[model samples]
Target: MSAHSPLPSHELAIRVRALQVGFGTRLVLNNLELDVRRGEVLGFVGGSGTGKSVLARTILGLVQKRAGRVEVFGEDLDQLSKEGHRAMERRWGVLFQHGALFSGLTVLQNVQVPMREYLSLSPILMDELARLKIALVGLKPEAADKYPSELSGGMIKRAALARALALDPELVFLDEPTSGLDPISAAEFDELIKTLQQTLGLTVFMVTHDLDSLYSVCDRVAALADGKVIATGTIEQMLAAEHPWLRTYFHGTRASRLTLARAQSTGA
Candidate 1:
């Protein structure tokens, strides 16, 4: 149908219906359904291996679905032609876990990878765009020339994010964006994500476990369990949920302490 030729008219940027995925004898996602709305930051949460990343990979067409319909920008992925698939890919970006930057490449070269793959531009222009993206993610210009090994944890994240933003994508898939950071650095990264989301009008599909990220940046949160989405709502709504996992997750000791501390600080 060549759905990529013209953008479809719909509120959803990504939709999954009756999805099933597995490895060998183990099932990962079963009859899972989800929707990421246009221009909204949707936080996807799950325990260590409940298939949050699997679902995201399925939507990105990185994982094969056994039985399901997956759509992005209103185009059914199963129906897209090769060229159509490439066109769809151009409209989105992804930040894999641990930044996944090439250990050998400088931040600038890493950020230019996508541009080099999907675009045909002069080296000068690519350099300029990559630097702009690095700056956009709050990295200083000098950091662009550093390799991933030489950068701090936060800088690695920012550098990878610059690569994700390289194509000026309308949709961004972030896997554990705040993982491996100190609390303060994590908070700062969350703020940067929020600012970029607002400034770019981006639809962000973030797979994360950070409660602070959920509370501060996500417009809505979806929790995965039993290979399906068990609950979806704001942080407040999640906190109020009575589901066993939700209750333990949101009201457990660490979560409770965070909530209480926020309350006390606000009162002061």
Candidate 2:
């Protein structure tokens, strides 16, 4: 058998070009363009009402784009039929903002839902696969029998993540992964994302308002303002950005106060 060839550096997992979305006459995304490289984390950050979630939904084909092209794994989204769309969706996994688990299904069944719908695996093999995915997300074996309503917020998130990884997708999209959790739980979740990315070589595209999470986990951040990407770079680079919106967003009064206190304490 021949050895597997390395993937090309320029090959993108997801690409959007001049994407436009609108609801009736109200424009959401305005000619937005983005590219998510393989095995990298790209964070989308903006204040409320910036249409970040709309852009994500457009890319996922949950909503129709008014204009522009969304290409996933190099296939034009508009070119796919209903059946073709289902086939393409198997290549991605999504962790919704609230861990949208089926309340009626147990954790194992929740994770196996996709497998049952998409694959022809036997019950034994499906169970084995579901268990492996649950374990991969650090869920206890016993938790597999529990329902979503019985699990804590963190467990629900983990179970949702397990379901997302059920198909071993090449691309994963997370929306507000840390929302509504205590600081400790949120930080733990961020670390979990880092660990999973390293272990599974997954490409993560997350939309969040958590500055701490952006600084801690993101390799690069794309800031959306006025329905377009205003800046995209490392945290340090974003800190140095001269755009008024970026500066105010990243080094605002709150951050400045924190910096001043630390500086006075350390004399730096």
Candidate 3:
């Protein structure tokens, strides 16, 4: 084969190498490796207890890793000084599973939390930005003053998403984004994510078990098992994978409704 043109190094969003994580005697991820490219929505999936969320947490620096390195936007996380770390943190946003919004804070205030922590903007500017984020995620102005308890599952998810996008982040980590929504609501949320990703040129690392979300929005799929990413490619490659877990996952009863048979084209 002729030599392929090289992709620019700046195109890498996240790179994990020789990662190891454990809690006491129980090791979760071992020697795991993965890469997320810029401007793509990469769906991460695995069976329950496979350490998908754990891996995400480790990369975010919320959970300590026993070994290996994580680099984001081409910078080694460990090498960054305190200020550098804070700067790095500003470039990415995260929406945890279960819409982890603060019950005491209203939706608008929640959206402004990151801004308060990372930015030095006037209150008037902050309010304007927060409202924009809420609207961007499909939430109404009325929902802005409601507490978490006042929102339904779907509304909470949208409010949480608005908070995640508050900083105009280049990348976002979504953990089970569609988890508790009704089918229709989930579909709508998936569409919103796709639109934002394209319009904003945001790279998304979505950890989800929702196959429909995977099929509808992902540019590529990565399957995790036994503490590492066992396979990664377009959805068609996932359906053809010989790996036992991936075989059942991609060709299972739940995946039967996808009408697209050809390999799903990834974004350049």
For model 1, the local distance difference test gives 0.89
Error of 1 at 220 (Å): 0.2
Q: Which ten residues in a row have the lowest lDDT in candidate 1?
A: 1-10
| Candidate 3 Cα lDDT to native | 0.89
Candidate 3, residues 14-36, lDDT tens digits: the string is 88888999999998998888888
lDDT (Cα, tens digit) per residue for candidate 2, span 84-174: 8998888789998889999999999999999999999999999999999898777899999999999988888889989988988878999
**Model 3 Cα shift for residue 83 (angstroms):** 0.5
- Backbone clash tally for model 3? 0
Runs with alpha carbons beyond 4 Å of true place in candidate 3: 1-8, 258-268
Q: Estimate each model's TM-score.
A: 0.93, 0.88, 0.92
Cα RMSD of all models vs. native, in order, equals 4.4, 5.6, 4.0
List runs of model 2 lying over 4 Å from the truth.
1-10, 81-83, 256-268
At residue 57, give the lDDT of candidate 3: 96
Which clashing pairs does model 3 show? none
Please identify model 1 stretches exceeding 4 Å from their true place: 1-9
Error of 1 at 177 (Å): 0.6
